[model samples]
Target: MAKDHIDPVEELRQNTAQPFEQAHAMPPSVYTSDEFLNEELEHIFSKDWFCVGRADALKEPGAYTTCELAGQPVLVIRDRDGELRAMSNVCLHRMSTLLHGNGKTRAIVCPYHAWTYNLDGSLRGAPAMTLNEGFCKDQYQLPQVKCQEWLGWVFITLNADAPDVSDQLAQVEEMIAGYDMTNYTEAFYEEHVWDTNWKVLAENFMESYHLPVCHSGTIGGLSKLEDMICPPGLPAFNYHTILKDEELRIAMAHAKNDRLKGEERRTTYLLAIYPSLLITLTPGYFWYLSLHPKGPGQVLIRFGGGMSNDFADDPDIDQNFADLKALLDDVNVEDRGCTEKVFKGLSSDRAVPGHLSHLERPNYDFAQYLMARINAGRGN
Candidate 1:
């Protein structure tokens, strides 16, 4: 007798139905199935806002970066007027990508055929095209993608009808106003393609439960499980607060910072912005990882970090950032190992889910968010 094949969407519905206390991890197939990943791409990634990186990274005119979103090549650039714009990276003539990576360029010239475009995506010059009788460069322009800057982060979307990201994250703005997140200087940024399901890494970041074990060599000793506070998530995001041990002075407020008071001075916020932005914000520093699925078992990560203005005037600022960057690099190594192992386990036929821990409220909430986004506009 053949066993009935289970539908991934059906499993997702069942997982999301359980109350937080009675919740269990999502089905292993959700992370390992190619069919489910395609569905997510069609729905969530295609229609929702995706963060690329900090706004300040593209501060100068002609600064630009090339990336892929929802399988479309995208170019994010600063125009001659110093304004951020997102456009199709595909050239108008024969479809060659206009840019490769992050750098500054006075104009976009296709490497394949030398088709030139202004920073604003206007067709600037096309060599030898004038020989053709009916060709007009004025008629060609790269299609624009919707872009907005929110709290110092640059987000773009292919869907024009999607809600504004700033309006969607109003609660987060109110909650972290004391920290003035926009003023945090980005000291370093890097891109890494890791071997893991994007969702697996996202869930790993949503909870502190794994820290004491998975991150034992780096940040584990500083994270005490008892100090964590996990609450039910809101629609746009989920977050957990941790009270840092005062011995970790950088996690505590500096003398220059007067906006934070009481526990706010000693608290750290771990924020999971729905779909794929993960942020770790402390009183003195902030770091975030924005993920995009590369395949069924791979993820592209845009990782960056910086310190708050309070530490801007410290005499040892250079040494302090060097030490901080070193620690962050070590943390990334631990996290990559842990998340890749989870993905490997999920690939096995015998893998089954167990009940969620009380501290995994965010993961349960994340399941609900995923189901809601995937099933939306489908009339399910």
Candidate 2:
């Protein structure tokens, strides 16, 4: 796989023309290989700024949650002092699991050996260590992971040695710099398990070519398909698709107030951060989407969002949330159905890496980024 001589961009350019045609498709093995999936888990997911949840999840002191990322179980907790901590969810003794799920707890007591850990991941007591055999309690704390909070979201990386989240995410940060994402609060959150590779979903999200057909009922008639589509530049990590008010009003009918009439609706934005996080920002609406690979052919998608401050307590917010969820569920179902069917083709012997049209610059960039990382043997 050390395609050192393979110019991935050049290869993509040859197959895709200016208007951009989806030329070269991913090879079959990319989706069905257990080996490649493991590599992605270790190298991409573990080392990247994987989203755990929103900062609001840890709003209360001693609030804790458990989640899995790249096949690794993780414990995220807000300590008594209101500091957030991320640690391996494995017990130091016998390597058993620690926290079971999300809850508020003063401390975590490992069920296996009753080994207890403080909210900050400090080893508090080891009930079974009677020998005192040169073992310091301080040395037995749960292993810590790199973590950071940005724009009201909690992100953690299993690779303690990875680059700073800011550094790795600079391009995306710059692209979304003008938006005030922190102003909103979590108004929606959900998760779905899909039967396709995470990259497939990423590729689909990075482009809008399928929006008209795949999301016709929800967004097609509402958006200026041609105008919203643009070449996603060198962030090589993500892309942005703009939707103006005309389209927004049509898709999100609930947003049809006089304040957003005509030109006022020209401010919808969709951004995909490198690796997995997707954020859609509007005049007063926000949505967060995170995708994670579960196995070779399975990926999990989590949804989160915030609303405008003015409407935080509005009862209509519930209806809006439900509507948005239904819209997304339809889109998800459409994407999953087509992608799973496409997976069968990608797994066929007739497949090979396809080309990218000029419009697929983002997709090409992402493919190149992933390939370069893998070929370089960089992993968590």
Candidate 3:
């Protein structure tokens, strides 16, 4: 198949290396061309630390789930020894996907030839292999991938040289230390496929510029442009703060803790962890979106959230979550409408880079990160 290609690194560098007043958005081809998407898959997704899910999801020894990373089938399982393992999901015999979706399994059994594997990915049993010559079971284990845990989230990478997830997110950890995220229980999780580029969804979450416009009916009424504070981007992530109006600040269902101070009680922090993790933290709760590109115009979104431990035992917890979920659903609908329209607009021949607003500093930082990865991959 012939592939459509674009040199996004050069285009991004040209568009972003200027004063904020003079800078423009990224080129249309960077979002619409299959060639650039392929490059991102190799240079960014393949080498970066990708967040999969919350660590609390795998509560049992045999709990497991499957996903694809950079087009490679992969699985994460909790072994009997209480350790999490990430490895290829492809079977050694016929290359069939070993598992589907998620479940509690005593052992991984391939549906193709009935080849079986232990919870640790070691080959446990193979039917009708007695006639084979010099087949050693010890040598047939599934290949392991690099995996790490941070702030109760599971992250994995295909590249052996990728930086440690903990090191990259150290500052973010310190900033949110008052949240006590490790003790936050998983209240809910859901997945959806959006008809927009992965970067489109990511950029949407990174900036607060649209909150007053796009989300007017839901959250916009409570936001003010002057209250937003955009922090300088760190080497590994970018963050911004939105202050809540005193009158609009509703008392949290969760009990207040001393770790947070006056402003912290009225502030919301939004963080973009480089390539794909988008997180939002509030005094009462937190939520995140882990993005995966399915194609040039499709993104797989894993969205989930939970309340802080202060509200873990609240009698009205269920009602609180219901209200939260409904608000989130409405906000998502508004965002989807805007992003899908932007994707279509990018396909037009007249499409070109537009001037960015002061509120879009995080988007500028994201472009820099994208360009750095592409250039590094090309050995430039």
Candidate 4:
């Protein structure tokens, strides 16, 4: 006996085509199939504005970080002229990766050979290249990738025609105007690899349907499904609102600011920005997850958050961050357990699409985005 083969693209289009009231989850194959993952890497992630990290992380001139975007090695640096740049990390000589991790350096020197590049990615030195005929060092700079900074975050895209990240997230900026996130400073950052499909982790972040159950001991006690408001997805993002019954403990820990008032003071906004940017905003704090698909069953996550500048300047800021990290870690543990289980369940041959709760509207919209990207790849 064998499982029935399903075409992920068609199944996704059909499932997402149903009305919101009648929608179903995408088939398991969309998450478990290698073919579908490859298609996603090419059509969606590679062609979209993918967030890497905060611009503040590279605040000083000569600061740099290396990361992989859709399996392409990318180097992001701040030049001596104070310009932010993103470019291929591969060495022009023998194709070696030029940098690893993050650091501050005047030049990028390849480990394979002494081939060095200036901070701006211009070829600075090529050891023993004089033997090569017609090899112009001036013409051998690392290929450039499109990069932009929006509201303090750095985003890069492999697609030459992709819309600027600022334009894509313009609505999000307006929606969170009251919070003044641009003035926030990162309090902490961490990276983790989860044993779950990238979409599983993404959809998990989009909906609060699992909060009262999955996150029972942590933030769950502060929330109720009835208090959750599911807003429709925009062309580039989807958001939900959660109203606090009592003033948030974290908010109380910080000094009050007039930036947020009335219901905005008590409401939390959770946004999934298209392909892989997940953000959560409270009156006093903001955090985000920048996700990258490592494979069918692995996702690399960059998780971090910051407090309002006023809050960040508090005398007890260190203590506040410790408490926040503890709470966030507990919540992340719960999410990891749930999503890993979901990934295992998705592997079952009998796994099928399930009806979505009204609260899962963001997940529904995500499926629509996935379908649209897949179809667009085929020019359909």
What are the lDDT figures for the candidates, one per model?
Answer: 0.91, 0.69, 0.85, 0.86
TM-score per prediction, in order, is 0.98, 0.82, 0.95, 0.96
Among these predictions, the greatest lDDT belongs to 1
List the pairs of residues colliding in candidate 2. 20-357, 24-354, 24-355, 25-354, 28-346, 222-247, 245-265
- Model 1, 1-380: lDDT tens per residue? 88578788889998899888799999987898888888889888998899988988999999987789989999999999889999999999989888997999999999988999998999999888878988899988999999999999999999999899989999999999999999988888899999999999999999999999998998898979999999999988999998888877777888888999999999999999888999999998899999999988999999998988789889987787788789999999999999999999999889999999989999999999889988784657
How many clashing pairs in candidate 2? 7
lDDT of 2: 0.69
TM-score for model 2? 0.82
Stretches > 4 Å off in candidate 2 = 1-23, 128-136, 244-265, 313-315, 352-357, 378-380
Candidate 3 residue lDDT tens string, 1-380: 77555576567778767766676878988887788899899999999988888889887998987889999999999999999999999999889999887778999999999999998999998999888888878889999999898989989999999989888899999998887778777778888999999998899998889999999989897778998988668878998989765553232324457788877876888989978999887777778999999998999998888877787667877787778778888999999999999899988878887888888888888888898888899897
In candidate 3 the C-alpha lDDT for residue 118 amounts to: 97
In model 1, which residue pairs have backbone atoms overlapping below 3 Å? none
How many backbone clashes are present in model 1?
A: 0
lDDT of 3: 0.85
